[model samples]
Target: MVKLSLCAIVKDEEACIGRCLDSVKEVVDEIVILDTGSRDRTVEIARDYGAQIEHYQWNDDFAAARNAALQYVTGDWVLVLDADEILHPEIVPQLQEAIASDRHLAINLVRQEIGAKQSPYSLVSRLFRPLPGIQFSRPYHALIDDSVTEFMAQQPDRWDIGYLSSVAIVHDGYRPEAIAARDKLSRIRKAMERYLSEHPDDAYTCSKLGALYVQNGEIEAGLKLLRKGLKQEKHLDRLLRYELHYHAGIALSKQQKVGKAKSHYEAAIALNILPALKIGAYNNLGNLYMQTGDLTGAIAAYERVWQIDPNLPIAHFNLGLALKEKGKLNEAIAAYHHAIELDPTYAEAYQNIAVILLKNGKVFESLDHFRKAIALYERRDSPAGSELRSTLKEMGFKI
Candidate 1:
């Protein structure tokens, strides 16, 4: 039995601290929280869960706050989590077993971004032994990877890094609403820009900030940073390389440089990385193929996506589109049904199914699906609802 501690840095996280604490209370032997000037009941909530709370001055640097929290951890292993994240219950036993191993100095846990549509899963080095040499780095996206690498380099064969394939944490911070509430975009940009100023050639920061730039509609600047990141041959790790190429592909695609984007996507997909991590590149590549009228390529890419993660509704929906375009009506309908099965409220899938049903002369069945889709779309205030209503009217139906 190994002692596991939960360490976190929080400020004004009253709404989510209790949820975060509850998820790990049964698993961790100790709870250490570093409060960085919380003006709310964050400390009070944490105290209810028996968290050892310490006050620290608010600093813009996340790594500084994280490192400060680490000093208070007494347990042999630390499980780092954010206030907006909860440990998945199913991964607890596996996590315990991994941490108990004498050979593993650190364990990387897979995190599922709750509200993100693309690249929903990510790997985070959250579980590790609290060794003196192991500390966090980077200001915005703080991580212990650099320190862990440095420590491992000293005794390359003495310790091993472990990984859990199952999702360990469910993070809610990436949601659109959450991002808006936290003003995360501007805050992260400011921090990363400052960090990049100091370390211009940092590939990790380049990948992250470059992606942020692309998302903010600064495609040319984003491409410049992404290409700069690719040029850093020595500092590029497998994950960083994948991100650089993936983001470069996104930027290139936005510019309508389909050929370059396809090449970059191929490069990203070719990387010896986790198949789940390549989902975004594959999905985007599939879309590109669809744009170029390469239905076969599009179908293959989408099928690959669903095979990697069957639960992804978008993959099935995209596959349905490709199959529909390829004249495989039955297969298309089946794919649409899979998408609906994964996400019952998927209005677009229902609409597509209705279109296919009508094409096959199943008028009444098509109308039923159209009604469902229209009702769902109207509830979401989507313009598709009115468009669908008009389409039905033109077809001599009054629903």
Candidate 2:
């Protein structure tokens, strides 16, 4: 029987701590918390869950705090978790089996962030054996498995780190409501500023900071920083290079620098980034070509997205728009149907298809679709629905 220890570091996590603990309390042998000066009921809630709590002084170093927590874990295997995440109940058996296996040294757990697909999701190394040499590094966004890699480098046979398909953790720390509650965007900017000041040549940090600025609506500042980071492309890893170009492309588009923006989008595509990001870049390029009156280029770009991911509604909708503009009526209608298949409640798609049908003398069927779109839109009180209804009434069609 292998004992598993659940370890976490938290501060002011009152709103989420209980939920985190309740989800995992059934599986672990012991629970430990390292409180970094929490001024809330976090400690109290942790205590209720039989978690051994110890206070650690805040040193602006995540790795230090995490390493300190490692000292208290007595179990044969350790599982790292945060206050805003939960171990999925479905994964409990997989976790237990992993620890019981004597062959594995480390386990890469799946972290499914809500609302995002797992493309290029680097398996977060959260489960590991408590070896003497293993510890964490980095001041922020701490590298939890750094010491494991170093220890494995000498004895390659001992490097049995692998991913588990059965277990997945749901993390909600990046939720919009959570971000708004903690002023997370403001904190990210401040942290990035400090990180960049100390490590000016770190292109990945520059990429993150640049993207942060763009998200905060500082478009020019974001573009400037991203462009500067792009100059050190050799220093950037593959994903960060993709992200830098992607952020800069978005900012350029906002500034109406279409040609420059298109180049950056194309560059991100060339980098072979995450599949979701690649699809997004293609869609942006497609939209850019459409806006610039290059119908042929737009069609090609949208075709790339369709080939990559036919399930994405936006890609189909955009393809429909381009096909319609190209006067390919049957293809346009098929594309719109594809969009509707992916998103059955898409009123705009219904509206568009209805208009096309009405123009093609399919009056009764077209009127039925128009009514369906209007019903859904009116339920939501959308302006587009009202305007569409007004147009139908003016055309002498009874609704």
Candidate 3:
């Protein structure tokens, strides 16, 4: 059996360290943690799992902390994770097999970002051999890609990079509540801004920092940085390039530059990347098409979204709207039903269905759906609930 080691750098992560360790304790042969000034029981929790802990100074550098953790790893392979992430149980066997392979030096694991509605899945190169030349880079959002690339170039025939399609890690650090608690946005922005000043041409940093600017409502600055990143297009990998274009599309759409936004969306979709990663671009493009009265294009994009991930309620709901606009009442109702099946509390889906039913003379069925929608809306304290009640009452409908 191939021995695997878990490496992590944490500070004040007492709340989630135990959960992270628990998920991988059975699979990993050794646990190594580098603590950078934790005032809580984070080190104590890690010790309970028999982790080899090392104390390091807080330098505000994620890559430095991660590399420090690698020093204590003695296993044949290393699996890097954060305190807020858990190794998915289903990927245990897959992970073991991948690391055991002779041809693979590193594997890109799929990570599901919890609470992220726009882009939930991402690829992270967190599994690799602890080679001398392979270390992490970037001050924030640190990754080993740069070092791995260098190492691969130095020894071209040594090993190749591999990927696992199934989600290997579930990360909750991006959740709204988690972000608020940690104030991650402000910290990340400071780190990236400082790094970008020193390395302005760095496409990866540009892409990330640009997106952060857009999220912070600094659209002009975000577009400027994203465009700067695009100027170095030849140096970017498929993933970085896709992100740049996707983010540019978002920033442009916010400015109401529809033509430019569509172009960027198309560029992102045309990239040689995973279809799952293109869901945001496809969905946004569909919305633009819908706004421009392009029913065919809207329907096609929404259908593509459905094909990529049928479990998404929003995809089904969006398709229903496009179908409704196209005057396909039956098809629209069916799509809305699919949305409701996926999410029972989807008030908009119920209300839309009710409207269609009422238009078709199915008064009783419409009333039932409307009541369900109103109850759900009221639960969320939405004004739509009272508005619908008033409209129904004005129509002489008895409750």
Could you say which candidate leads in lDDT? 1
**Residues 62-113 of candidate 3: C-alpha lDDT, one tens digit per residue:** 9888998898999989999999999999999888888889989899999988
Task: Write the number of the candidate with greater lDDT, choosing between 2 and 3.
Answer: 3
Query: What is the C-alpha local distance difference test score of each model?
Result: 0.94, 0.82, 0.93
If scored against the real structure, what TM-score would every candidate get?
A: 0.96, 0.71, 0.92
Ranking by TM-score: 1, 3, 2
lDDT of 1 by residue, 81-186 (tens): 9999999999998998998899999999999998877688888999999999799988899999999999999999999999999889999999888999989999
What is the clash count of model 2?
0
**In TM-score terms, which candidate is top?**
1
Worst 10 residues of 2 by lDDT: 114-123
The better candidate by lDDT, 1 or 2, is 1
lDDT ranking, best first = 1, 3, 2
| Predictions: Cα RMSD each | 1.4, 4.9, 2.2
For model 3, the stretches where C-alpha displacement exceeds 4 angstroms are 374-399
**True-vs-predicted CA distance for residue 323, candidate 3, Å:** 1.4
